[model samples]
Target: MGHAPVMTWTVRRAGPGDVGELARINCESWQHSARGVVPDVLLDRMLPESYLNGWRRWVRLPDPDGVFVAEDEAGRLGSYCTVAEARDDDDIHADLRTGELIGVHADPLHMGTGAGRAVHDAALDHLAEQGFRYAVLWVLKDDWTTRSFYAHHGWRHDGATKDHAAGDQRVPVVRYGRFLNARKRNRPPSGFRFPAFG
Candidate 1:
């Protein structure tokens, strides 16, 4: 019923029923990422419930699109990802190459076991299928793991950074973008390399 183990997995279009697992993973990812700024007590109290309500609310939002959980051969959830349409001045950027990776998390219990890759592959496939050519996600400047992850996954920097409002504080985040329509070798010339540990 929950995330466990499997060889290959399935990724479906997420719906209302997915709120619970989605919430769980979201909270787990956030709680892990928001180490000091978010107090332990506050995270413990707010994360799970916030995830539940937030997923529910987002699922009901207009034109709100996202993929479902990646279920293993054992019929359990492994990982989850969501792609949101991005609004930008560049039509190419906004249309084929400009979606936002909103949430991507694997069950901590199942972390580093290919579940994350499965979810990522499924989400990218979904984006390509939907005619998206560019995609982006925000990552904390201080979080090397996630930054390294996106870099390893073929995402490149657009040379853009932002100070976004998170809770009661400002967080420095980097923007990682992928050009779906470009040649596979046409990546940003940052000369950055991140080893995919998975």
Candidate 2:
């Protein structure tokens, strides 16, 4: 019996032409993942066109390093991630040179297909390449799946918390951070294994 061909993914910087699909992916991924976390009304009100316009404007700005997308050999976009300098309100414990993983999303159908990991690794590499010593990200406090994913990838929560206003509700979030160079040394605490790409 013949084995199925192994699927591979490639990560690349997003361009102007990708804004429409990126907006669709962002909207769909958010609706799937944040259905209960974010207000249903807000999620329902999200328009892909609005996100497309926003992405278009963002990509046109002076950011040479901004967003990235992961695609399979079949040219399907499976995941995307965005990185930026840490914001003052991010409550990060790292130095001012830290970078932030502002957003990451995987198409629900591609959740376990390694696309997410590829985007994440690419984002970290981009941050390190840009001379950021540390990286930080925020997750909903009750998002165990996301928290576990970050922890398994060598990130640690540093007791920082923030509440983001969503409509009339406040959603609590926690911060996770990791040293970019330390990851290169494969020194993740508790023997966490960084999976190698095929």
Candidate 3:
């Protein structure tokens, strides 16, 4: 087999103007990357135009939550990453120091070209900068390719599982976690809370 093509890209915080392209990329990546993992019924509903408004709203959200995109030298965006503080008050740790890797999706044409990695790394850096001590992500249990990708990057399955809603279906997903910045653990002062990202 031919070697996987090498790809070069730079990551940056997403802006209002990027919503359209980011929406397109999100829908396209889901259609391609989640093909066999997510139920066909759900994947079939992923349409670029339908995602534009959602992308617009998401990109406008404040810090602690972030959206980033990877662009090649030619100015074409190849992937995007979204992150925030972990939302689950049950199951996953939902504290000031815990964050979530909401998603990292790449254009099908850039799947093996390193675009995903660039944005993924940048998302983690953003979380660390926000003072997150740990990060978690959820992936379809059957998406071996994606699970392996996270594993290669030092994430470990954290023995948590949930039935995530995918359209009308509930599909099993596993959680993976990694330490963004390992340090002695200390409790936040009573009544202390990080500013809400929502």
* Candidate 1: Cα lDDT at 159: 67
Clashes of each: 7, 0, 0
Q: Ten residues in a row with the worst lDDT in model 2?
A: 189-198
Residue pairs in candidate 2 whose N, alpha carbon or C atoms collide under 3 angstroms: none
> Quick one: best lDDT, which candidate?
3
**lDDT (10s digit) by residue, model 2, range 1-198:** 443333588999888988988898888887888888888898888778978778997666554257889998888888899888777644443233578888788887777678878888988888888887677788888777778878878888877788978667899989887878777553544554432211
Which 10-residue span in candidate 3 carries the lowest summed lDDT?
Answer: 181-190
lDDT string for model 1 (119-169, tens) is 777777767677676677777777776677678778877667888676666
Sliding window of 10 residues with minimal summed lDDT for model 1: 189-198
lDDT of 2 at 179: 76
- Residue 68, candidate 1: C-alpha displacement in angstroms: 2.9
lDDT of 2: 0.77
Candidate 2 wrong stretches, greater than 4 Å: 1-6, 62-64, 89-96, 184-198
Sorted by TM-score, highest first, which candidate order results? 3, 2, 1
Q: Please, what is the TM-score per model?
A: 0.77, 0.84, 0.87
